[model samples]
Every structure is written in structure tokens, then in C-alpha cells.
Target: MPSETQLAYFLQQLLNAAPLSALYAMLAFGYSLSFALTKRADFTPGALFAFAGQVFVYFTAFGYDRLWLVYPAALALGVAASLAYTMLASTLTGSKVIRPLSQMSPNSVITASLAIMIVLMELVRIAANTRDLWLSPFLNQRITFWDHPGFPVVMTQIQIMNALAMAAIVFAAAYILQRSRQGRNWRAVSDDPFAAALLGIDPGRVIVFAGLTTAAFSAISGIMATAYYGSMDFGAGLMFGLKVVMIAAIGDQSSPARSAAGAALFGLAETFWGAYMPYVWRDLAMFSTLVVLAVVMRQERRV
Candidate 1:
């Protein structure tokens, strides 16, 4: 049995994990949506995530200094710029790269997507001049949930808001995927693009829809993450993208709800690992687990 202090600490850690889990779940939801359509593990979303966050930071800094604007005004401008550029990038990739290479092998698509990731990372690095930019923190007031003699469970206001926001987006996306006509088209295309095309559904258009929707998700998450963490670096995109890919692959990638659930579990695992184990080994352990799961699943399929 756990003591009062131990239980309180446990609760505190759980609360801390909520926001992280939500972020992973949100990214996985977006990734799974497009992965279903493309039938390939596209690395573009990760790059877009990093790109959008960095772009927001860059423009916000510009607006704050060059335009002599307040934080709110600068943030608004940053949001607008991030959304515009992310969607444009996603559209171009979907049309020029993803669509054109659809008939090629999955490895071909993965290679092209990785190449795009590198290009976007370079663009971000060059634009920032290899500088790390940061935002002023806001809504950081701590909210205590359970108070005890030696331990108290608490979370920041912003963390709670971000978690709630991610949950809303996931639920909304699941609803759209299950109940909407466009959702039907997305699933149909994922199952059989040729059959969908024969049914008068343009597979290319479905891919465009997935791209745009995913861009929106990436932009929202990127902006929020930058606002919360004060900074987003160039290398974060690929790592985040890869982590979400692994999480989504563990779930039914074609189903948003299942993917989100899987991501949430990953998030909790990460948080718990950080708390109980050597923090340095957190990523290595989680990643190793994912790799093992992938290999086992493959072997099962073969059997």
C-alpha cells in the first residue's frame, strides 16, 4: 500500500502527464488520418510541425520588434503566418510530391517524404540563422488539485487548457471521420483508391483534403507548443514526427480513435518512465519498446 505522500506524488505525476499525452494523441490523430490515405509513413507532417512552430516564433519575434507590437498582436500575426505557410507547404507536397509518387512503391514515397523533411528543416534553419527563438510565457499560473502535508497535486492553467483543447480536437476529428461524407470518401480511398476512383470519387482530391486537414492540425499544435514551452527548435520536428508514427502504427492507423488512444498510452508511458527511471533512458526505452512491438507484429503477420 502507498502512503499519503506517495499517493499524492503519484497523482501529481499523472496530472503532469495529461498535457504531454494529449499532445502525442493529437499528433497521432493527424498523422493517422493522412497515413490512411497515402498508405505510407510520410515524414512531411513532422517537418511541417517543426516548420510551423519555428515560423510562428520567427514571425512573432519580427512582429514584436520590427512592428513594435504587443505580445497579443504579435502572437496573432504569428498564428496567421504559420497557418498560411503550413497549408501552402502541405498543399504543394500533396499535389506535386505525394500525388505524383502515389503509384510508386511505398519506399519511394517514404524516401521523397524524408527528402522533403530535410528541405524544410534546412529552410527553417536558414531563416532563423541557426538561432533559438523563444516566446514569453503566459497562463502559467499553477492550479492545485489536492493538497497534503508534504505533497500537493497541481498543474498549470495553460497545461489544463492545452489538454482540453487537444481532447476537443481529437473528438471532433473522430466525429468527422466517422459521420461525414468526406470521411467516407477518405476511408474508401484508403481501402482501394482504384475502386474509389471508379465510383466517381477523385482519389487525388481526397489526398488534398487529408493534406489540408493535417496542415491545420500541425499548425494548431505547433503554435500551442511554442506558446507553452517558450521555444521550438529545428530538430524537434523529425523526432516528434517519428514518435507519433510509432504510436500510430501500434494502433489501428486507419481509425483516429484507436490511434489517439494508443498515443495517450505512449504519453503516459513516457511520463511514468521519466518519473520512475533514469530520465536519460526514457526515449531509448520507449523507442526500443516500439521497435520490438513492430517486429513482433510483423512476425505474427507472417505466421
Candidate 2:
């Protein structure tokens, strides 16, 4: 039988990361979309993620909450940002990197992306620090327990809503991807861009939509993250975005739902090991798992 403390810890870990997993899933799907269209992995999504949330906060400050403009506002910012990135990347390297090895070398593009992320994040820091910017206390309300056995889960109002919102957004996206014409186009584009283009599909349009969808999903995901903590801190998106990239890549960027699974597993591992192992082993354990996972997935992909 599981110990009482163990049970409590497990449930808390789930509760904490389930909603958080949605954030991961959203970001991962975003990355995956871009990968699907461009046939490349990139870090531009990372910058878009951070800058999008900042846009949300900025709009909310502008008194645009009744329609909950934060969501769309963030998406628009991301669209603009990702659009600019796509345009520049295409103009500079779209034709230059058609070699087989160039297909695997996202590092050069991602390196350039790092600069965008840094500049965007620094601007956010400067703005928030120098100007009047404060998030509304969105999560002060907490769900109360009925004081029953295994029934007392103290979740914040915002956390609960954010979680529900995450679920709704993911479900909607998944459905659209599976059922809509545009989504089918995306699948065809992802399946084989060259083949799809030969079939008269516009690869550039596919890519543009893919990037737009990525930003759209990121809007929902980023704001939910903002609501989860009841505060927005500059630079937080970078850490979380990196983890999302790692997890998405680990899943080969093919399984979008794996984003959620990856997040939950990551949370569970961190909680379990942190509780049972020495602090020195924590980071090692996580990285080791990542390495092991990469190796295992490679074997599967090989076959």
C-alpha cells in the first residue's frame, strides 16, 4: 500500500502539473506546428512565447479584459513576431539550406533566434520595471475542501479555470487538426512537404498557417501560465520554453499530446526524486532521464 504521505504527494504532484502540463502541451504543439511546416526545428517559438505573454499583460493593462483581449492580443503579437521571424529567415536562408545535412541543422537558425528572445525579454523587463505594470490578482481565490477523505484539494480559482481553459483549447485544436480542411492540409504538408507541393498545395501557405496556429495556441497557453501563478515575471518564459522544446523534441515533435504526458511525467519525476533523493542527484536524474529517453526514442525511430 502506498503510504499516506506518498499518496498525498502523488496527488499534489498531479494537481500541480496537470494544468501545467496543458501549458507544455500548448507550447509543444506550437513548436511541432512550425516544425511540420518548415521541416525544421527552431527556437523562434521561444521568443514568440515570451513576447506574446508580455503583449497579453500589456493589453490587459490597457483595459481590454471584458472581451478577454489578453488571449487574442497575445496571439496577434506572436503572429507579428513569428511572421517577422519567418520572413527574415526565409529571405536569408530558405534557399541556401536545401542539403540533407541542412535539414538537421537548426542550430544556426536557432542561434540567431536567441538574440530575438533576449532582446524581447529585456524590453519586457525594462518596461515592467520602469512603467506602471501590474497583473490583476487573478488567483487569490482558492477552491475549498469539503474536509472529506482524499477529497480536499485546495486549488486556486485561477488555476482551476486555467486548467479548464487549457483543456478546452487543446481539445479544440486537436479537433480542428483532425477534422478541418485546413488541418488536413497541415497533415498533408507535414507528411511530405515536397509531395504536397507537387500535388499543387501551397507549401508557403501551409507554413504560414502552421506558424499562425503555433502562435494562436501559444496565446492560450502563455496566458494560462500567467494566470496559474497570478503574476507575470520577465524571463520566466525562457526557462519554461526550453523545457517545452526539450520535451517536444524528445517526443520527436510528432505526438502533440505527448506534450502533456511529458509535463506530467517530468513533474512526477521531480517531485518523487526530490522527496526521496539527495538534492545533488535531482538535476542529474532529470538530465539522465532525458538522455535515456532520447536514446530509446532513437532506437524506435530507427526501426
Candidate 3:
């Protein structure tokens, strides 16, 4: 049996892990959703995430401290911009003109996605006239759960919102995928596009829906991240996007639930590692674990 101190430390870790896990889960879902249609990972979401924040902050700055109007306008513009990027990516990947080429070389799709990411990031940098942008902190209020000698568990409103948003997104995705006609169409298309088309389900329509849904996930997560950190850099999205792709791939990309679970596990590992280990070893430890897991998974598949 563990002592009270051990339990306290564990609880503290859980509190710290929740928001990061939620963010990772949202990103992973974006990757999974896009992959369901294209059968390839889409790197576009990361760029969209960064672009969403930049657009939101840029619009909000115009409001001159009037949050009521600023917030709505900023959100609308941000979501619209993100969805536009998604539509572009969907068209590039699913258009009849490109489909033949992409089918011949799947890497062509990845290359196009990378190109989209680069172009968007560049556009955001030019629009902002800088690589970094900051937003005024909206929810800095904290709620303390427990206080111990060396373990204090407290969360901000933004953190709670992040977790809640993630939960809501997951439930909504599950319900739509399992209970809706469009969801059934998406699944059928993913399983076999030719068969789905024969059944009167249009693969192009499914692809567009996947892209839009994934974009919404990325945009919401971008908004939450900016709200939590109060600032963002143009280059941050690439690393975030790649990490999400890795997490989803490792988690069994076909299942959203598994991808979410993988993200939660990653969050817990990162939190505990940060808490217990030196800062220098933080990323190294986490990534090394991921590599080992990937190798093990690959071997299991072969066996």
C-alpha cells in the first residue's frame, strides 16, 4: 500500500497532466480524422492551429479591449481561416486531378501537406509582421484542490476549460462516428472507398467532412492553447503537429478512443518526468520511451 505522501504526489501529477493530455488528444484526433479519409497523415492541422491563434489575436487587437465584441469576431475569423486552410488541403489531396498522382505516390500527399504548412506559417508571419504574437490572458483565475508540504494541486480556469473542451469533443466525435449517417459513410469510405462509392456514398464528400472536422479540432485547440499560454510562436505548430501524428500512429490510428488514451498516457509520462527528473532529461526521456514503444509495436505487428 502507498503512503499518503505518495498518493498526494500522484494526485498532483494527475492535475498537472489533465490539460496537456487534453491538448494532445485533440491534436491526435485531428490527425486520425484526416488519416481516415486520405489514408495518410495530414500535417496541415498544425499550421492551421498556429494560423488560428495569429488570426484571433490580430482581430482581437482591433477591438481595443472591448472583449464582448472582440471575442466573437476573433473566434469567427479564426475558425473561418482554419476551415479555409482545411478545404484547400482537402482539395489538393482529394481532387480528381491530384488523386491519380497521390495514389501512385502517397508521399506526394505528405509533400503537399508540408507545403501547405510552410505557406500558411509564412503567411501568418507576414501578416503579423513578426514570428511571435501574444494575447491578453483571459482566465488566470486559479482553483486550488489541495496543498501539501511539497505537493500543491491547483488549476486555472483555462486548464479546466481545456479538459472540459477535450471531453466534449471526444464525446461528440464518438457519437457522430457511431450514431450518425455521415459517420457511417465516413467509416465505409475509410474501409474501402470503391465499395463505399458503390453504396452511393461519395468519398469526396467524406474527405471534405473529415478535413473540416479536423480543422475545427485544431482551431479550438489553438484557441485554448493561446488562452492558456497567453502567447504563441509561428514555429510551434510544426513540432506540435508532428508529436500528435506520432501519438496517433502509436495509438492505432484507426480508433479515436485509442488515440486519446495514448495522448493521456503521454501527458502523464511528460508530467511525471518533468516533476521528478532534471529539466535536461525531460524531452529525452519522453521521446526515448516513445521510440521504444514504437519499435515494440512494430515487432508485435510482424509477429
Candidate 4:
């Protein structure tokens, strides 16, 4: 049996992990949506994640500076801009670049996605002049669940809201994917594009549709993260994207539920590491574990 203090600490860490894990799960599910269909790990969604948040910050700043916008108005404007840009970019990329290149070679799609990621990063860097663009945090009131003297298990309102929102989004998406005609078309294309076409399903249209939903998920996570953390670095997208890719790959990428579950587990493990291990070693530890998992999974596949 653990002591009271140790139990309190563990509970506190678990509560702290919830929001982060939800964010990871949301991003991974978005990546998996299109990955399942195309089998191409188009990394632009990573850049899209950063891009959405940065765009939100930029537009909100504009509203504040020129329009004398209030908090609500600024937030609405920022969200609209972020979603619009993300949707446009995602749809165009899927229809024009990724879909065509994917047909040629998966490697080509990967290279193109990397190039797109670099371009997005550069655009964000140039827009911000390589400076930190910050947002004013809101809905950050801490809610204490167990006030264990010196070790209170606390969570913020925004964190709870974020977790609930992501959970709702994932469940809703899963439901739609499993029950809707569009879902059937998506799965058909994912299984075999030629077969899907023979069945009168337009694979290209399904890819574009998946891309739009991916954009929606990316914008949502990006906005929530920016709002919670007060800002996100534009350059963080690559690492964020790579980490999510690895996490989703570790899961059953064919199913959103499994991808989310894997991502949540990864998130919990990562948060625990940060709590128990040296902060500097957290990323190294997580990535190393992922690499080991990848090797093990590959070997198992071969065997």
C-alpha cells in the first residue's frame, strides 16, 4: 500500500495527464483519418496544426490592434480565420498534391509533405519575425478535486473542457465513420482504391473529404492548445507531427478508437515521465521507447 502523500501525488499526476493525452489523441486521430484512406503519412497536418494556432493568434492580434475588438469578438475572428485557412490548405493539398503524388509513390508523398512542412514553418517564422506571438489565456480557473493538504489534485476548467471536447469529437467521428455511407466509401477506398472506384465510390472525393475533417481536427486541437498554453511555437509542428505519427503507427491506424487509445497511453506515459524523471530527458525517453516499439512491431510482422 502507498502512503497518503504518494497516493495524492499519483492522483494529481493522473489528473494533469488527462488534458495532454486528449490533445495527443485528437491530433493522432486526425492524422489517422486520412492515413487510413491513403496509407500515405502526409506530414502537412503537423504543419497544419501549428499553422492553425499561429493564424488564430495573428488574426486575433489584428482584431485587437485595428478593430478594437473585445475578447469574444477577437476569439471568434481568430477561430474563423484559423478554420478557413486550415480547410482551404488541407483540401487543396489533398486534391492537387498529396492525392496525385500518392498515386506515384508513397516516398514522393513523404518528400512533398516534408517540403510543405518546411514552407509552412518558414511562412509562420516570417509572419512572426521569429518572435513569440502570445494569446491571453482564459477559462483557466483551477478546480481542486482532492485537497490533500499540500498535494491537491487539481485541474483547470479549460483542461476539463478540452478533454470533454476531444472525447466528443473522437466519438462522434467514430460513429460517423462506422455508420454513415460516407464512412463506407472511405473504408472501401482505404481497402482498395480500384475496388472502391468499381463500386461507384470516388476515391479522390473521399480523400478530399477526409482531408477536410483532418483540418477540422487540427484546427480544434491547435486552437485549444494555444488557448490553454497561451501560445504555440510555429517550429514545434514538426516534432509534434512526428510524435503523433509514431504514436498512431503504434496503434491500429485503421481504426480511430485504437489510434486514440494508443495516443492517450503515450500521453500518460509521457506525463508520468515528466513528473518522475528529469524534464530534459523526457523527450529522449519517450522517443526511444517509440523507436523500440517500432522495431519490435516490425520484427513481429516479419516473423
Q: lDDT per residue, candidate 4, 1-303, as tens digits?
A: 348878999998898898889998999888898888877666777888988898888888878877999988998999999889878877777778887887778679888888877887788778778878888878889999998886778889998998888888888888888999998898899899999899899988897888888888988899888888888787778888888788888886666778888999999999999998899999999999988886776577569
TM-scores of all models?
0.95, 0.75, 0.86, 0.95
Steric clash pairs (candidate 4): none
lDDT of each candidate versus the true structure: 0.86, 0.63, 0.74, 0.85
Clashing pairs for predicted structure model 3, backbone only? none
Q: How accurate is candidate 1 locally (lDDT)?
A: 0.86
Least well predicted 10-residue stretch by lDDT in candidate 3:
89-98
Best by lDDT: 1
- Each model's Cα RMSD: 1.7, 5.7, 3.4, 1.7
Give lDDT tens digits, candidate 3, residues 1-303.
347678788887788888888888888877787786776766777777776666666655545354455665655654465456545644554464335646698777667767767776787788778746566666778888877666566788888988888878877887788899988888899899999999999998887778777777877787677767776677877877777877887787777768877987898789888988897898787777777887787688679
* Residue 210 local lDDT, model 1: 83
Cα deviation at 208, candidate 1, in Å, is 1.2
Clash totals in order: 0, 0, 0, 0
State residue 228's C-alpha deviation in candidate 3, in Å.
0.9
